[model samples]
Target: MDTIFYNVMMKSLRNGKQWEVLEELAMEMIEKGIQLDNVSYSTIITCAKRCNFFDKAIEWFERMYRTGLMPDEVTYSAILDVYAKLGKTEEVLSLYDRARADGWEPDAVTFSVLGKMYGEIGDYDGIQYVLQEMRGIGIKPNLIVYNTLLEAMGKAGKPGLARSLFDEMIRSGLQPNVITLTALIKIYGKARWARDAFELWEEIKSNNWPVDFILYNTLLSMCADLGREEEAEKLFDDMKKSELCKPDSWSYTAMLNIYCNGGEVEKAHELFREMLGSGNKLNVMSFTCLIQCYGRAKRFDDVVEVFNIMVERGVRPDDRLCGCLLSVLTFSKNGEFGSVLICLEKANRRLVHFIDILDKEEATLDMVKEKFREILNESVVEVRRPYCNCLIDICCNRGLTKRAHELLYLGNLFGLYSNLNTKTEMEWSLNLRSLSVGAAFTAFEEWLRALIEGIEHNERLPTCFAIHTGVGGRKLSQGLADSLSLHLKKMGSPFQQSEERAGWFVAAREEVVLWVRSLDSKSLLATA
Candidate 1:
């Protein structure tokens, strides 16, 4: 048969989704000495792409180029999408440049695919360039293109930009679909714009727009993060009521987190049981949230039980879960410590070793520090702060003030607590906002010693000094601030509570110096 006949037959097969047969017919055509034109190649490439046969699509695209028959815009877009799906950044860019040079103006579909690729790689500038080029070519962005851009902005955490684009999309006379609303919800969620997210969700409901699983889950997760227990419960109920959507594992996990954050352990447990009864497998996050809730409530037995269940189900604990387990150890009784330690050993051996060293009375500060450094180096960065806080809290509970100070110092050395102390020309401040109560006290003691040494050496101190113990939101931090106030009053320290600040104590330079002079050097050093 001639090339036209082969092309017609292949296009029919491609439309029927017969990808394998289509490819075989193409090979047969080649063997019969039939020259494949651009249409024939485009049909084959599009078919392979639709079937997720990315390698086959690339092969046919290369073959088309080798035949010296330039691909039209459709083929270019198809192959570009294939390259994008494969994460072939170099190939995507090179082909896009070649297409533009050949005078192919990409349509909305092409721009959407490119926007997705750029978004995945965190190249916001490239997405903007795509938008600008699309406008320059007089091709107004459709719903698909706008959805892609908004999704990218969400991932980039540019909520403002996403809002503007969403507004522009509506003004362009294209109705917002579920994908568009879902992207906007995600942007608001990521940026922590709770008010905006809730408002948008309300609008979505008022308009009675069709809501899918992703849209419902996105809102639920946002509510979980913002600790909007009422809002999350409402969203979860609405999701259940929707015939088109049901609570998946992530949905249950998010709702469970909301309950956990609100300290509604009974509700969390009820929902967790319901989730398991529905045959939705629990993930590490679900178990972590449950353990955290149990830890906070001082229910050590429940924490261990949930952990045992997680192990039985073969859900290997991650670093965050291990960190949560360590946190439980801080509140655990001396006898209860060993039980949590067992779970920690199963989760992460390094953490177990670190805890073991800290528990050992004979372990020197150097040994604990060495083990700490090793664990910090091996752990993911997000867990480092929590691990340090838990360890310092544990030490303080054990009356290991000196060891706690050394660990806090090592945390600073690792740049985990860089802003614990800050100096300026007008004010010198010690920020213990992120530190545990015990670590904060240890840091304050160290700062006082340094102040005395500086005064003895005639070093220039700031005109005013402030100690920040953090605000009144956290129970432990507020308790520390209150205790520090009482301690300062009992010692006749020069520092006085600032009337304007809830957690700040201030002292003038001369008062601080005199206070330091009056403090017995041996007594202060002995306290350390």
Candidate 2:
């Protein structure tokens, strides 16, 4: 009679609508002196996970263990779900090992979760192993398993393999769901196999599957990839009308890209403003399209304006964003250079301030980490190699060696490579106007050491040249110029006057060049 009552109570709890109701029922059962069995504990844990009450789920697991109850594969899988939600990959793996040790074979749900984890991390081999192991245990691969493996293959750059698997799954009589079709479309889209992509899209439409946001986004992306702006626009309009698929930031970004790349800047700008007014949280990618569009049109004032507003809105600029802005500065006419510089200077100062805060003695290491994470999340750091090079170049030109060196060090720590061009740009930007001959030589040596240190680990050593010259109307004295030339010649570096840029002495070694402006006749050399 008691066992029958226990089973009845477990069933009621399992079917409970809310986790709170289940918890209340469990407490009531405990007060009534009812013994909860393994089924009872498992139901509670599963319910807690479904409700996102991970902490409560963990407590129930611990309580079950304390009561000397062994967790079944279902119980362990439920616990793994909780850990997966918490993103504790190690714990998930650890529990998997424990389940195996306890002689509990994993079920399909367990395999699915493990496969999904492996797929996410691009561990194609692991995903395959999980699938094979499931078969070894007599568990047939389900549609979810096949879909996950296909997606994993695509992500791992084995699109051919992914397509083969998709065909295999279909032949095995497993119906490809919407997710399956989307993943296949993405693979075809990425490879620019337009025919295959369209074929798959036609299947989706023929099936009369409910058109959702993911499907529209995927199709729009495919159209964008094929440079079919008309088709992409039609899809976008259809997406707007669909009650099921509301436009979000990603969808907007894809459409914006289609317009921008098509040279429809006005349309892109109109959509951009609408996106802004839509109260969507714009990410860095969202702004990059318009920035690049303005840059392509040489509307630099608009480029700078957008960049300034991006920063003003507290959007942390990434390397791509900074690179876009730098490209603007690099191509800007001399008359507009100063204005661009002013905007860049403002942005740079803000970055420097953040760097300074990270250096404060009172800021704990953990706090520094938190701040760095916040900077990354908030879109303020310019960490891309090109952008870092641009920042380093500006710092070098402005005689901010400490800041430049710090940036170089940070770049190195961040695994940014110093390419030959990047190194040359830095050396080219080095100004020697303020340093005396002796001071200039010392500065040059320090710069060379720092440059070499930053790029030593790179697979290819880039030949670099430094062009250091006096400021406008100020040139190196004859004696100092000659001394510098003699030093280069003594070091086996070749020195010759550049016929093109007057007063410029070009010296070359095996991989490094030193360009010195000589005022041997007291005439100022043009800045390179």
Candidate 3:
């Protein structure tokens, strides 16, 4: 009957209805006065943990103890696992203490869980104590124990300790597995210790250990970070040629990023096609890489093309991609106003096309306004704060003061994102420069006229910029919207530091033009 109950409960747990089955069985047992055995209680406790009902698990455990059934090794291990995941380090210690006091020897599984718990909390000494206790009890440390300790050491930034542990494991006649190697590789890669990482790779190859997909992917990522495209390509090819291992989605993404970062768009595109052909679902990072690749080459058309493909495929554009699109549309490295205008106009059209596809009747605006409307809408996509900042600057540069104020309104509705600094900004400014083809403003008056023309509109900030802060929008404090408006109004001042505010004040010149354009309204200055 006990064997039958256990089997029935196991099936229920596997089917994800463990709690219901356990409840019914417990009632039946109690009504019949069938004394539940250690196996029955242990199974209930284990099932509760697996189902993530920690409270219920604890209840079952306490009831088992009250029933005068002393837990065996499996029960102890299950409870220890629950405590570890809950970060109940104190409870774990208390359990360990009672088990030892009651003359119960901790087994390999128990010690392993304890070691992992200690490692997670950076309690290296605790880990050492656990190992010593295991040895004292004559229970030998196994591969799983070593791997957990090594991973903890790596996470704690104690690479030296991890290496020592690896050596100790080897000296004990236990071979390091792929998990062990991957942990060490991650540590070296993070520290940028290329020599050690390569040495470990060579050791793995020489020892005839199976070079799996994860190992290759890890090394490829390391190469990408270190800017070693040639080596990354070779590793990628090796993975492709290997009969034992097949590259997965991660493998293709890593190689694509490597090629893109190296400015080899052609190669990146080739691998992208291969990834698509292999039936691996391409992720947002894949599309992000390609957008960044074309942006680097100043091919805004390609950037928009890829972005269209991404949305059309139902892959939502994230904040990261929004930053990329903003850069591609706004910053032109070559100060050719003509080319910049042309690119902006083309991008503007593409964005409008996107809005048309969405076909929301509520989005009633011209091409430029609708484009921004879609960009800032969180229900559509969660645009990051940095992207918002960039778009604001883009609007300012294009003489879309109303549009810029409108973005500020959206920022208010969406809540302004702090820590505006990001890598995308650096990449944008570094590659973007002036492309010259237009007439030089030799006269001050001519420059002033041009500057005013760029920012002639005198739209009220609050009225035009107000976006409905719905459930998805972040609620901001009062006065933030006013402050943002004031800062933008001051941008047209001759004293406004365009050089310091790289994204905002790039093209405008002349004190009068700057001052005039900075007004809240043309009528305000006129009335004054």
Candidate 4:
């Protein structure tokens, strides 16, 4: 049979989804010396794609190129999608450029595929380039392209860019669907723009727009993050009332988180019971949130009860949960410490061992640092800050000032704390914004000693110096700032709280130098 006959049969089989027969016929055509043309190759490549035979599609694409036959627009788009699905980003770019150079205009489907590929790799610039190229070629973006771009921007944390794109989509006379609104909501949530997210959600409800489980869960999760207890309660009620959707495990977890964070422990416990009665599987996050709530309320017995329940249910404690348990240890009474340690041993034995070493009088700072490093190395990166904070707080509460300082220094050495001290040409600054009170005190003493050393070596000092103790947002941090203020006054230090800056204490260079010089050897030795 001629090439045209084989192409016709292959096209029939491709349409019928008979991919295996299609491949066989393709091989028969090649063996029979039937010179495959562009049409024949395109049919096989399309069939390969439909059957998820990406490698076969690439092989045929290369074969067609070798025969000096350029793929038509449809084939070019198909192969681009194939390369994208295979994650061959370089190949996709090269082929896309070749197609554009050959005067092949990308259709809406091509643009959508390219946008999705860029989104997968988090290449925001590449996604923007695709949009620009589409508009440059007089191709207006459709709903799919806009949705892809918005979702990508949301993940990239570009809320402003996402908002503009969303507005432009509306201005282009395209209707904003649930997906579009959901993406905007997620962008706002990630940027912590709670006001914008709530406003958009209100608009959705006012318009009676359709909302799915994912969208509901996204909003509830945002509410949990922003501590919008009232809003979350209302939304949870609406979700329960919806005939189109029902709350799942994630919905319950998010609501639980909201109530826990708001200190509504009774409400959280009620929801927890409802979740269990509804047969929803309990997870680590739900347990962690409840434990944190109990810890905050100083309900130590309840904390132990919930932790035991979590273990009984086969939900393994994650790093965050372990960190949470360690934090509870800082506030726990001596009698309560052993029980919390027992629970922590199940989550992470290294943490218990570190605590045990801290209790040992003979345990040196080096031993403590080594164990701390081991625990940090085993834990995930997200838990590092909290773990360090909990350990430092524990040491401080136990009156282990020297150990706390050493641990804070080790944290700096491990790159957990950065920019604690910064020197610019005009100002030298010490930032204790993220430190606990005990850690901040040690850091301040260390900074003062460094200043003395700099002066002794005749190193030039900036004309002004500032120490920032973050005072707003967190009550605990406010106490830290207040303690530092009192300490500075007691020591007759030259640094004074800045009236202009809420969290800053500034000192003039001349007074600071004089204060450092006047310090006797005993005072200096005490700081050391």
lDDT of each: 0.85, 0.66, 0.63, 0.86
Worst 10 residues of 2 by lDDT: 519-528
State the weakest 10-residue window (summed lDDT) of model 4: 471-480
Residue-by-residue lDDT tens digits, candidate 2, 459-484? 24334344444323112134345655
- Give the RMSD in angstroms, all C-alphas superposed, for model 2: 11.7
Task: Return the lDDT, model 1, position 386.
Answer: 82
Residue-by-residue lDDT tens digits, candidate 4, 267-346: 98889879878887888998998888788778888889999989899999999999999888877877778888888998
| TM-score, candidate number 3 | 0.65
Assess candidate 1 and give its TM-score to the true structure: 0.77
Q: Higher-TM-score candidate among 3 and 4? A: 4
* Number of the top TM-score candidate: 4
Candidate 1 colliding pairs, count:
0
lDDT at residue 88 of model 3 (Cα atoms): 97
TM-score of each: 0.77, 0.57, 0.65, 0.83
Q: What 10-residue stretch in candidate 1 is worst by lDDT?
A: 470-479
Give a tens-digit lDDT track for model 3, residues 175-223.
8888888888887887777778888888888987656778888998898
Candidates sorted on lDDT, descending: 4, 1, 2, 3
